[model samples]
Target: MSIPIWKYALSMLTYFVVLLCITELLRKKYKLANIVWICSLLTFPLWLMGGVSGWFRWAKILSVILPTIVVGFCRIANFEERKGSFWEFFQKGWILWFVYGMLFLNILEATLKDVSLGNYANAACGFLLCATIPFAPKFWEYSKTGEGDLICYTTVGWNFLYTTWNLCFVYGESPNYFASTICILMAAELYPIFKKKPELYIMSRVYTLATHMILRSCFGTMFLKVMDASTWYNASFAKYWGILNFILIIPYLFWYMWQLHTGKAEISFKRGKTNNNVTTLNT
Candidate 1:
């Protein structure tokens, strides 16, 4: 089978351009990070709209255009600042292993292209390894305390959940889940680098809200398209799942909004030294 060369190229270009722009904003107009995120959010619904309508043609076109525009604007704005060293920023105690584990799993799935009971077993074993390994506690601590400039443990936790879902449900060779999984994972991995930077956090939360909103809306729209109102209302699984997700998301959304309003939503590094430094000492 032939690959969709143009689509792949466009996707990569969009990602690079958007990242470049966001990086610029992180340095210059830090306050506008959230706005940048809001911009990124628009792409998701366009994608879903294309998906539910089976407008693969238009979806592919949009997947490229939207990201390009968002990123281009960021680049033109030219807003970045100098900060910590990459190693200083990235070197966390325990969290590295979790990241490594994720990378490992991504590689395995990409190479293997198969998921079976055995694969699930291996994943469980890997998780166990991640938990029991000497480094696990450190990672846990880093995650909990937001050490090494880590912002929220939610970053890794969300990525883990999203990646697990993708592996379980969207493991096809040419995975449609790539955009979502990659976006989330990259954000989580970079959380440490951007930890001391509040602007980045604001942008990230905005991005998260936008992404989730688009996803939920798209799913809702798709449900409407596929099932009549009567059928949807009668479908206990869909009905309850949607309601539960909505209820759960409400508190989270409110909390995030509170943080934004209170200016607590920005990324922050730990002040002074950490007392409970459980991770390996930097060499």
Candidate 2:
């Protein structure tokens, strides 16, 4: 079935508006964001039963992990990045490394799912993406201000790779919902673009993903029912995207490692400025 351009456009527009609002509310206010954080945690089991993962084991894993990501990311945002605080301890402590671990688990879930579905090409890409995780912790810098100033300071290069990898994962897992899901992903990227703050990428992604998951839970057939959107799944479509993800990520991973080895990785501070000489992690 051919989906009209207008339908895609409308879906994109609707998601962009709704998600941007959710992101802003979560980003700009501490109390509200905290409320959402609490609510999301409390509602976790409900989300699992809310038609969230369907029959996909990967989706079930994601249903658990994503909300946890939201909570952890929010807690990182909740702490003031000043001296002698728990937040400071978290940044310095070994526990903070779990942040990266959680991220790796999230990616692995999708990769494993791709493998189970016989998406060999995408699974290969997913494993390659996982390989990049050890190198990833250095790329992100986290901080929060008074009220709601949770900032991740994610760089452009890293976010681009992540967004592309995730898009391919979604394509592999839920091609039938790709059109609508693309809107959510695009909206996530758009938040950073519109805000003119590249650091907002991860923050935007966390909230938008949470919001989309909630919507999916509550209105499982929203896109098809409300928008009259067409849905289809194709192995070739999934395979081609998986192939593309693999091809694109391999060179970038090599380049990333080269940068690290050469002591030239883009390391950003809280303000998002790059320090080329500093090899160790900077927060």
lDDT of each: 0.37, 0.62
Give model 2's TM-score versus the native structure. 0.78
Off by over 4 Å in 1: 4-10, 23-31, 35-48, 52-119, 122-174, 179-283
Q: Which candidate gets the maximum TM-score versus the true structure?
A: 2
Q: Which residues of candidate 2, in runs, are more than 4 Å off?
A: 1-5, 41-49, 53-92, 134-137, 144-155, 227-230, 266-283
* Cα lDDT of model 1 by residue, 1-283, tens digit: 2335564456544543455444444534434543554465566666555454434333433343344234323222222212356434333333344433443443344323323322343243233323322223232222212212222233333333333433332223223343433444355345435545331342343343234334434564432232212321223442343334334434544554564468653331222233343334232
What range of 10 consecutive residues in model 2 has the weakest lDDT sum?
274-283
Of candidate 1, the 10-residue stretch with the lowest lDDT total is 143-152
What TM-score number comes out for model 1? Answer: 0.30
Residues 38-143, candidate 2, lDDT per residue (tens digit)? 5655565665665555456436445544554544543543354345554454445333355556666667887887888788887887787677654344554444
| Model 2 C-alpha RMSD to native | 4.5
Model 2's alpha-carbon lDDT is 0.62
